[model samples]
Target: INHQTWYIKAEWRGIDLVPRMLELFEGHHEYPVTEKVRIDVLRRFGYYSTESNGHLSEYVAWYRKRPEEIARWIDTGSWINGETGGYLRVCTEGRNWFETEFPQWLAEAPKSFAASERSGEHGSYIIEGLETGRIYRGHFNVINGSTITNLPPDAVVEVPGYVDRNGLNIPRVGDLPLGCAAVCNQSISVQRLAVHAAVTGDDRLLRQAFLMDPLVGAVCTPPEIWQMVDEMLVAGEAWLPQYADAIAAAKARLAQGKAIPTRTGYAGAARLHTKTIDEMRADRVNSQRNAEATDKAKLRPAAAKKAG
Candidate 1:
């Protein structure tokens, strides 16, 4: 009876039990055996497919059976005979593994791993108290525990907690500098103009200051005054001081009149600098023509060589 039971167990192991156990072991335990080595391994090759149980399991099994064939496919353009064509290629290039057979699954795992690693690297701000101004600035890992080594105990602080989409905790600090409101209000006009100039990259704010309001232009709108000075220098004006005096006179004339002057300040100076807008446009055209002529002169030798 004992002999019969031993024979029965041996037969069961030989039949389906051994193969099934091997498959299960390979799928879960065997491949992930060395935690230290597996981390570095998965960091390179990534992980296996979590989708399509029977088909994926079979695909993994086939690769495991013939390691040499997979290596050949990587080195030379070779294929393995499987459900997928012999065209399936697998190899590690640089830090990535290229697999043609299970391309989709293999590609997805590494990208997911990289994204997770990137998220781990990004730093988050921490806020401590609502009424006080205490805070911490550093990074923390979700997988491992965090250490809070740095802190300023005497500082007033505000701490607001929030979680991101990846379930990462983020802290917000709510604290304003002293006398911020009064300073902002006092400098609002120039601040708005500077912000507009920064956003638009248009020199109109400078132009407005120099042409419409020289007092404001000289102080708040210095950019326009400097621009006019540059133009005057370019136009071969003998004395900038004289031109500045002329601009000041124009500003005074506009200020005397309640209605905004049709022509004033830097507008008059610009008119004097270029004579007229039509003349300025003509000069620009002439300058472009001169540049083109100079380029053509340089290219003549190249054109002659091509012709020859």
Candidate 2:
């Protein structure tokens, strides 16, 4: 989504993926392309600001600031430094990007072939090996426990898999460097808590999930977390049949009148307005390009400046 860095998308076989690929296709160096490809691959693995996902750096800033807590969490010093921690920093943030930029993209859709740009993470799987009875190797993404062995088996994981005639094969990725697993485990804990809370109507667990979130915990106090959770549950009451009792309780709490101070009318730290259709019509070429390009941000003003 970061427009200035669209070239980096070519490196989508991320940190976890490259290692698995190196293992899967170990001895099959048949093509004249292998030498140059290997050099380029190693160069990227060595030099690029490799992260599993976007904006993870923002999330890990919390752990980096508190060394003792990070040490306790990961229990290993091997991956605590700047280099390996880069992977941990690959968590996620930036909801404001979606809120602000997405409407602009959607508005452009009516005037351009924007529909072609929405193929996010969807991949082709049907291989020639299925018809021919010969083995053709390729990588695939599957939903499974394909990450570190220590993570819960039932937890849904997105990882690269080996695909061919038989099926998608998810390999055991042993353990992510301890620190990396620690960061993933934190989010997993929140997800599990949220799921259990929704299924069982346990408001307490839901509150805890909010408290457990790295971004939420870093920004909001306990009182603010509690109030926010209550407000959300109440607002979403219609869809949350299991939360009926909790929503009623939340209304009673809100009725008590004393509310924590909050920043009213706060535009987020990085907010951009969605352009109106008429505004887009002023620059039809760029608007059409933004709508059709998979890297939507590539045509944004800041991105254009950076690209130049």
Candidate 3:
């Protein structure tokens, strides 16, 4: 099962997990994964979280928000750790890769295709546990009730749980360490407000949600935050049918010409400028792997070391 990146192979083969990871990264100057953000957090927070660099980076305020700081934390050569819009570009290229490979896969011998190794996704194992009453231990995203006492009960949390004939059964995690829970509770507040604002179409709550977001609040003033939300609503009005009235209100506010200004040049803390095909061809192997791999940070996990 895919519990954590390190735990995946360890769970199956019983390898020494955490220390092996520290040794793997012991003296590397550059990140083997999302190097800067992960290492910094591990130093700041005593516990090692299971999330890889990409997902973990977004949750914290240290890695992103300013251009100057972004360069220090980001790896230009990597997919998950590079500048802004990297995820979208990588996703688009991945789709292109699949589209190009699918016909070739179809025309190839059926036995050749069918005999390939299976994927590492947890879906198959979960099904096996539920169908045959085997116990499968892994991390699952589940709604929080009493599982984490410090977090909002309605929020979703990633935690260890087991599957069996009874289905996915989650137990109380009691409480996260003080630092981790502090981080988690911040996210829960943003998520709770964002969901409520979306469902209720409350502009006030929506603005509050932005203000509560760690990165957004750190990077923008209240008026700037509100205006940014207005711009987003007006731009994405096509999919936001419930926000028609709110969009109209925001447009009227912008029409009055009193809205706080936003920075057009702020490309985000970790975003890189787009490269042309010739530029990408300079590093064909990495470019191709960046485009093709579904989870680019698949083998890489978090590493945190304590001070003596």
Clashing pairs for predicted structure model 2, backbone only: 56-89, 56-90, 56-91, 57-89
Deviating ranges (above 4 Å) for candidate 1? 1-163, 166-178, 181-192, 198-201, 206-308
Best by lDDT: 3
TM-score of 2: 0.59
lDDT of each: 0.30, 0.51, 0.69
Better of 1 and 3 by lDDT: 3
lDDT ranking, best first: 3, 2, 1
Residue-level lDDT of model 1, residues 141-251, one tens digit each, is 222111111212222222223433434354432222223222222233344554564355334553442433312332334544554534433354343343454445445
Give the runs in model 3 whose Cα sits over 4 Å from its true position: 1-33, 97-116, 273-293, 299-308
Q: Report how far residue 218 has shifted in candidate 2, in Å.
A: 0.5
- For model 2, the superposed segments whose C-alpha errors exceed 4 Å read 1-54, 57-122, 126-147, 289-308
Question: Least lDDT summed over 10 consecutive residues: which range in candidate 2?
Answer: 1-10
Q: Is candidate 1 or candidate 3 better by TM-score?
A: 3
For residues 79-152, write the lDDT of model 2, one tens digit per residue. Answer: 11222332222111123233445767677746433656544433333444555445544434344353447667
